[model samples]
Target: MPAPHLLLVEDEPRMAAFLLAGLEEEGYRVRWVDRGLPALEAVGREPFDAVLLDVRLPDLDGVEVCRRLRLHHPALPILMLTALDAVEDRVRGLRSGADDYLPKPFAFEELLARVEALLRRARTAPALSELTDEPLRLDLTARTCTVGGRPLDLTPREFDLLAYFLARPGQVLSRDEIHRDVWGHDFDRGTNLIDVYVGYVRRKLQEAGCPDRLQTVRGLGYRYVPVSASLHDDTA
Candidate 1:
């Protein structure tokens, strides 16, 4: 595919120029707009993988812009940028259809990270249906996870890991495989990150009073044993 296109909507010219230059250096194709109305017009004219929208504009409110985009362009990832840092303001932005939030005076690195994560999340939204075990559904679109009729509170990474495992249920996935599959291939392997995250998953399951569905494959890897199979085998 072509380099991801970003619609950058910030009223300040210098800030918009900085973002455009930085993101272009990172190989993203950016189209910068200085107002909400033109941003909406540009978005309506074509497709973009993600949008960085300023929450305040000279003639239009950013929340309403987000709402309009969401009504018609629901799948497009929208990251809201604002000087407002109040919890209520953040909540309002999210409730108004922003997929991610970034406050002013933010690090450029953090903004890039949020943009990448939002795009990643958007990419996975459509393929989520085929990435889970039956009856234990994970709707990435709805941002809900359910296991055997019980809902689970999972952090984003945990949810991704679980969904990945369920998609390949009964298969022994190595630490490297797990990391490459869920965390991305660029993830550093030197750290014991997979082990730590697995431990987190186990603790969450145990705390939820599960029947111990996750199993260590005797120093090799991990597997998600089905609840029924656990009962009959007794040794898993």
Candidate 2:
């Protein structure tokens, strides 16, 4: 297979240099751009496998660049890099059509893992089937999720999280297990990344008028209790 082509858009010289060297070392074809316009132009000229976009750019907001890229290349995998780790910031990136979000000051291992997962999903998307937990259904192929037959708008990460839960009904999943399985990363004790995403999915499910399928098991992790059947939330 050919090397994955990646476009890196960052304004900071040192950061760009660091990422450029690391990505190159990992045997990826990376194109560096200092501004948003150039990044867009570059993508138009070449077929890139993925894009590493910074949220703050000199010429344009990285989120807007992502939105534009999504409009033209809906299937293109985009990972947004930013210093902000707020829930809204992450949601904004995903809403702009980013396949993944990695905050700045992250380990290169995590970035590489995210990029790989996005690429893997892209390559295997056509072979995926819809996952369902009764009223909640996730069309993995279309990347669309619905609850109770009503379409629910989900961020890429949120959809993946819910799909993971639906795929393993009644199984108590630890935080570390969820992180490793869902996003190809080990659980970080210092970060609440897993919790934040779980909260998002739970809230969305509730908003869709679904039951409290996700239950906190005191000292243990969580489990998906399907509503269609009499699945007990027996996690402890």
Candidate 3:
């Protein structure tokens, strides 16, 4: 197979040079762009396997660029680069359509690993028909959700969380498991990001009139009750 092509959008000349050298050394064909507009133009005119998008760009913020990119290439892998390590920043990047995120001052090896993982996922992602449970439906290929045939608008992270739950219907999933499966990593026990996202998904589900299928397990974690099952009776 040909070497994977990557588009790097970084305004900092030194950082861009460093990444270009590192990625090229790993056998990736790299195209470097310093501004969001040119980056978008480059992608429009060329085929790239993935994009390394800096969160702060010269012409436009990476979040806006990512959002626009998603409108045209929903399945493309976008790895966001940012100096800010705040959880909210990461969440914003993900919601804006980034496939993965790496805070700045990161190890080159770690960046390479993330880029490789994104490429692997993009190439091997499974295709499935709509996953249905009565009034709720999750179309994995289309990346859409609906309840009782009414569309549910969900952020990218919310959609991912729901998809993870639906994939393991009736199984009690610990917060650690959900974190690993959906976010591709583990978080501290004190972190409530998982709960926050679950709340988001739950509210959207309720708004869609899908009932409270996501049940809290008190001491354990949470379980997804399919529409066909009684939410209270299922103990998994």
Candidate 4:
């Protein structure tokens, strides 16, 4: 397959250079845009497998950019980068239609993993056709998801996280395993990255009326089982 094309929109020159170098090293073809307007124009002109958007921009805010992009192309996956880590900031990011949110000062390794996982999950079939205990339905080709006949407006990270569970339904996966598979092998397991993103997914699922599907296994890890399935099926 051709290398995945990534649209990186960051106002900070240093940050943009840093991310471009890292993504290029990972073999991704990247197109850099310094402001929101150019980013919007670029997205409208070409096809990108995924987008890395910064929240604070000179011309437009990241949330508005995400909203505009989603309006033009609903299926395009967007991951927002910002220094804002507060609950309300995160909420705003998702509400604006960003698929995932990454606070500033993130690890390059984690960034690569996130991009890869999003692309990986983007390659699955639609979730509606399958009614199994697995609550995920990925049509990677078309980049769409439908959980229990209801569509999930998943950011790239949520989609990748859901796809990871579907790939190993009913199996217990440690946080380390999830990070290795979803984030990348070089990611630091010490950070609360997994937990934070999982929380994001839960909130979105709840919005979709399928919050119960993604279960917290406490000390073990997390798993996804269809909410419509038997309550006794705790294996997921």
Candidate 5:
């Protein structure tokens, strides 16, 4: 496989140079952009495997850029870089559509590890095929989902989560498994990110007039029951 293409969006000259050199040395194809608008344009013009976005940008806030990027490429993995380490700041980044959050002053190795993890997950994800469960259909190649023949506007993470569950219909997945498979990270029992994303998927599925096929297994993580299957005891 070719080296993963990465987009580096950081305004600080010194920091950008450091990241660009380090990432290139690590065998990644790196494109460095200093401002938000240029970064947006670059992504629109080319395909990138992942993005390292700094929160402080010259033209637009990184979070805003992240949101816009999500609209354009809902499946692209985005790792947010920020000087602020507060929980709220991290939450803001994730809420804005970033797939992962890394505070600044972080070690280069950690950043590379995160990027590699994202790439691994992206590569290993189920092949691009139309996955269907009767009324619910997920077009993996197009990255579009429809429920009852009506499209659902799902966020990137939401789409991934739903796809993950739909791929393994009727299997009871643990939170740890879901975290590792969907988020490409070890599960942190303390964090509620998985549950939040699951809820997001559930809400969209509900809004699309699909049955709450996302069944909660009490202590177990969750399961997806195909609409064709019997739902005698499945809990939404």
Candidate 6:
């Protein structure tokens, strides 16, 4: 499949370079515009899956550009980025019809996740009631997990961590990805809470006789490996 294309509007050269490199590494096709007017022009000329708009711009303001863009393309996903942490700034961006907001100094993983989420919502689908990989069944609504019909008693955090891995079976989940999505915040260098939780979940899977094991990738993160081809994933 072709990668999703993105438009980035930021006046700072260093910040733009940082985002472009990181996003491109993740397989996105990105076009960089240093000003807001060019951003509007670019969107009018080409289709993009999403836009990462910075609050302050060289010519036109990002919020005004967002408002105008929304009028022109109502369905397009716009993710506003700003160093301003004020609630008013966020509210103004939302009022301008941005699809989401991310304050500056964000983890690249978090930014990537938000972009993915925007695309996901744009192409909305039926919600999954369960995430299953063979003998391991994670009930989405009931919030229960079972291995071979025997339930494994788990803490709320443990359950969420397992569910996360189950959703993306066989995918290499970065430490930051797990920390941000499962724990609902940025990955803190000062803490090893994610490691601690992952350990707990991994041990439970082992004890429950689950064929899929959460294997740490040493310096990277974890990948859940299905022991057999028949052990497949399904959102039922």
Question: How does candidate 4 score on lDDT?
Answer: 0.77
Report the alpha-carbon TM-score of model 2 versus the true structure: 0.54
- How far does residue 16 in candidate 3 sit from its true spot (Å)? 0.5
Q: What tens digits encode model 3's per-residue C-alpha lDDT throughout 1-236?
A: 99999999999999999999989998999999999989989988898999999999877789878876764566779999999999999998997779999998999989999999999998998534467787888786567888888899998878878877886788999987776556542356677999999999998888778787898998889998886677456542
TM-scores of all predicted structures: 0.54, 0.54, 0.55, 0.54, 0.57, 0.53
lDDT tens digits, residues 71-130, model 4? 445567889999989999999899767878889889988888788777777677332322
**Tens digits of per-residue lDDT for model 1, 1-236:** 89999999999988989999999999999999988889989988887999999999886678878866764455789999999999999998997779999999899999999999998998878633333454566775555777666888999778777766765667888987776556653478899888788788778777766555677887888998875565688687
Question: Which TM-score value belongs to model 5?
Answer: 0.57
List the pairs of residues colliding in candidate 3.
none
- Per-residue error for 225 in candidate 2, Å, reads 36
- Report lDDT per candidate: 0.80, 0.82, 0.85, 0.77, 0.84, 0.83
Per-residue accuracy of model 6 over 126-146 as CA lDDT, tens digit each: 546687787888886577889
User: Per-residue lDDT tens digits of candidate 5, residues 22-78?
Assistant: 989889999999999899899988889999999999888898888767654667899
Residue 53, candidate 5: alpha-carbon lDDT: 98
Strongest candidate by TM-score: 5
Q: What is the Cα-based lDDT of residue 182 in candidate 6?
A: 63
Best by lDDT: 3
Which tens-of-lDDT digit does each residue in 99-151 have in candidate 2?
89999799989988999998898898763367777687888657788777899
Candidate 1 lDDT trough over 10 residues, lowest sum: 127-136
Residue 25's lDDT in candidate 1? 98
Clashes of 6: 0
Model 1 residue 110 CA deviation (Å) reads 0.5
What candidate 3 gets wrong by more than 4 Å, as runs, is 126-236
Error of 3 at 154 (Å): 25
Q: What is the lDDT of candidate 5?
A: 0.84
Show the lowest summed lDDT stretch of 10 residues, model 2: 227-236
User: For every candidate structure, what is the RMSD over all alpha carbons to the true structure, in angstroms?
Assistant: 14.5, 11.2, 9.0, 12.6, 9.1, 15.3
- Name the candidate, 1 or 4, with the larger lDDT value: 1
Task: Pick out the ten consecutive residues of candidate 5 with the lowest summed lDDT.
Answer: 179-188
